[model samples]
Target chain A: SAVISQKPSRDICQRGTSLTIQCQVDSQVTMMFWYRQQPGQSLTLIATANQGSEATYESGFVIDKFPISRPNLTFSTLTVSNMSPEDSSIYLCSVGDRGSDTQYFGPGTRLTVL
Target chain B: DQQVKQNSPSLSVQEGRISILNCDYTNSMFDYFLWYKKYPAEGPTFLISISSIKDKNEDGRFTVFLNKSAKHLSLHIVPSQPGDSAVYFCAATPGVGNEKLTFGTGTRLTIIP
Candidate 1:
């Protein structure tokens, strides 16, 4: 299992503000993913961050709204741009080893947009 | 529509007993199924997984049973402990290696001590 950590564990931001969440892994990993879990809802994939390449955004999501940076194998960041009240959700980053199918999740950043 | 569904929103069981959580999927493309446990203020942790080829997989106190025909799967925890109290989510992926996962609404399991 990978040890994953996210910075700014929780934050309350005003509407129209942006917040960037950072994810760090103990060891290098091949795939990093961003997910959002809204209140009383299931997890939804936001994007897949690849090292030194552009992130792959899932349908219903766009790059301008959620920009991602995967500069290396052990680190990545997801920024929620021009946030709104609807953006209040738990953001999580997960790391996957190329060897196995398992993906370990970070502690998650809880965002509250008011 | 949600491809994966965990109909029950919450369940409660006594300690030292068995805890069973059920999940169903509508997408036939989903080949891999997984269970994740989440605590408040924390991200979900992978608990167990079962492939379409196998009907059952076990690890220590946790066991996952799959019914491919029904597109249903279940996670069973024996001798449920208070520490087992958490929200359990069911996720499925069509293929392996960086494929997107579809998650179901979680079931909050509370183990009564």
Candidate 2:
């Protein structure tokens, strides 16, 4: 199993503000993904970040609201812009080893907007 | 509409007993299914997975049963332990090499000692 970590484990921000959450993995991986788990809801993918390419946003999520940066295989960042109360959720980062179906996840960053 | 569904919101089981979690999917295209366990403030950890071709997969006390024709799958934890208390999520992907998944609303499981 890969060891994954996220920065700023929890944060409280104000409305109309943006917060950036960083994810780091101990090992290099080809595919990294951002997922949001809203209150009482299932995990929803925000985007897929691959090094040296534009992140692919999932349906109902957009680049403007959740811009992702994948600078290398071991790191990525997700910025939640102009956040509202509804944006309060647990953000998670996951890494998938090439040719494997399993995705390993980092301890999530819990965010709250007031 | 959710492609994957876990109709139960919560389940309680006694330790040393069996804990069964059920899940259903509406998408016929899904070929791989997985179960993940999540603790509070922690990301989901992969539990067990069953490929569509197999009807069952087991590891230790955890076993996953898949009924492809019914679009249903289940996770059975035999001799459940207190540590097994957590939110369990069921997810599915379309096919090989595609890791993208559709997840079901999690079921909170509590194991009473």
Off by over 4 Å in 2: none
DockQ (Cα-based) for each candidate: 0.73, 0.69
Candidate 2 chain A — worst ten consecutive residues by lDDT sum? A96-105
lDDT of 1 by residue, A46-105 (tens): 999989999999999999999999999999999999999999999999989665877889
Q: Pick the candidate with the highest lDDT.
A: 1
Native contacts retained by model 2, as a fraction? 0.55
RMSD of each: 0.9, 0.8
lDDT of 2 by residue, B1-113 (tens): 89999999999999999999999999999999999999998899999888999999999999999999999999999999999999999999987544787899999999999
Best by DockQ: 1
TM per prediction: 0.98, 0.98
Q: Residue A50 of candidate 2: its Cα lDDT?
A: 76
Instruction: Give the Å shift of residue A19 in candidate 2.
Output: 0.5
The DockQ of predicted model 1 stands at 0.73
- Decoy 1 TM-score against native: 0.98
